[model samples]
Target: MITVKAPGKLYIAGEYAVVESGFPAIIVALDQFVTATISPSDTFGSIVSKQYQENSIFWRRQGDEMVFDNRDNPFHYILSAISLTENYARETGQALGVYHLGINSELDSADGKKYGLGSSAAVTVATVKALCQFYHLPMDKSKLFKLAAIAHLSVQGNGSLGDIAASVYGGWIAYHSFDRQWLHLQRQQHSLTELLAMDWPDLKIELLTPPADLRLIIGWTGSPASTSHLVDKVAMVKAKQRGEYQTFLQDSKACLKRMVQGFRNGDLATIQTELRQNRQLLQGLGDFSHVTIETPILKKMIQIAETAGAAAKTSGAGGGDCGIVLIDRAIDSTQLLKQWAHEGIQRLNLNVHTVNDDVISKA
Candidate 1:
């Protein structure tokens, strides 16, 4: 069996601004992961993991097409991944055989909720890699990237593609889709390890979720958003203030530069300050939030985190999933966790694992 593990990613900076402008955003692989285990078969079929009480699904390939046994909406991404893999195989003359697939993912939703931690992207990355191994496709990361991207587009309709890219390649990635390219992506396998090896600079991070008894507090603005939707929304804004957007991009880039430097130097203060400023800059974008800074529960959580000495912002597609908070110093995580629980805020302990460090592969 060929096992492929993909990590869930968190966008540290350059949220909406990276939509079309080729800005640099940093993504780190969290401990949460989805694993795909595939073995050769005369037929083609995939088992969708229902780990964490999520439903398991099965799909099979008929000739050149993949058909799902269950036509539920949750299997949409799996179907999309299968379809994309089949297309890639056909175009590349690589036959994707029938295989027995078992997937196990570490992300815990406890009460059947989504955290927007790139679970879809992880699934796509895992599927693409597993299919590549199954078909013995001799493609490099770039080719794997293409197949995964097609799968992502199939489900997401549109995306920055940063999540999948980071999952596949791992570590600090600057995915600039505007130029139709990836730039300065650290592909070294040990990059994650190297990142984690650095002495964590007195900083604390909290990954929160809702009560295990309750679904994660996922707040929706009653608005469905896609990268395309926001990119189009920002188009008019950009046309009117091209100069301002350009300046924002320039400043944001500088912020990333400084943040990285601070990280390397173990300068916690600089990192904390820069993270806060970065979030402020991101919040300036109109669609960055469903409600104002003071009203929404998510934003309120950010404020509380800040008050408790954290630099925080909503993670991924900000209509709401999880808030990524940058802690200024090490605090009693257990106490903070309890505080959040009492306030009806869910707290998840997240240790952001940067790639290029440990080598974890299931082959």
Candidate 2:
């Protein structure tokens, strides 16, 4: 049996802006992970996830695709990974054997709510890693990232793939968006295997080492946010109002640049200022797009974090999910956490996952 794990990710800055080509976003991989265990199966292949559903899903390859017994499938990301990897092996003159897979995730709430910690991307990466390891395929972080991105984009249609990259590499990273327009057009003409063999030099990825003095606090908003819906809302607004959208993009790009510089130089003041400005810009985007990017709970949490001398803002697509708080080591987080709990926010105990270390461990 082979087991693989991949960490979830949080966006530090450049949320909506990274959807376009050439814009950069900062994301950090969290210690919490989605784990996949793969072992040989004689009769048939099955995917078991008690957290996601009541029963296991039985699947088999029918011709060139994986077919599930039931129509309502919750393991879409895993299926995509398996199908793509199988095709990749075949295209590269290799063969694969069937396996029984069990997936378990630590990225969900106690009561089963998703933490919006890029669970889909994590699972896809983990599945790909496990399958490749099972087959002894030569896979590195870069190749793994590309495979995961292809699977995720196949399932979600549109994404920056920042989360996918973070899961594969595992650490603080500054990632430029891929040319989704080109990828989408190519997908219509070629298969997944053909796409994987092609080189994409336009995508830029850089590793960042944050200062040791930097402190991070994550607070969950209890409600799960739909990134797809929020992204669609923004896309609609961009289509209707090109000038306003361009302005938002420009400001976001500037903010991201400053934040990246702050991380590189360990400038706390610059980081704080950019975070506040970025929050306001996100709120403005919410207003222009007619989507509630910042909820009342998130606003209250930010206010409380700032009152405690920490810079706070909503992470990812907002609406709900988690908010990030940056602080120095001098400030006590006891009162802040108490106030957040009083306001019904759950403080998540998480740390950054680094690429130099092994993110996956055998059971």
Worst 10 residues of 2 by lDDT: 354-363
Q: For every candidate structure, what is the RMSD over all alpha carbons to the true structure, in angstroms?
A: 10.2, 5.2
lDDT of 2 by residue, 133-180 (tens): 777676767778888888888877766999998998888999988898
TM-score of 2: 0.91
The per-prediction tally of clashing pairs is 18, 0
What lDDT score is found at residue 323 in candidate 1? Answer: 66
Compose the digit string of candidate 1's lDDT tens values, residues 1-363: 888787888776667655553555656667678888888776556575665335555467899898754322234666677776676566556654777777676654655455556777787788777776776656555555556765665555545677777776665454544332222132133242232233222211222221122111222222222333444456557777777677777887788677666655566676667777787776665433322322266676676666666567766556555666666344534454555566666665555544443323222
* lDDT of all predictions: 0.58, 0.85
Q: Pick the candidate with the highest lDDT.
A: 2
TM-score of 1: 0.70
Once superposed on the true structure, which residue ranges of model 2 sit more than 4 Å away at CA?
54-74, 188-194, 357-363
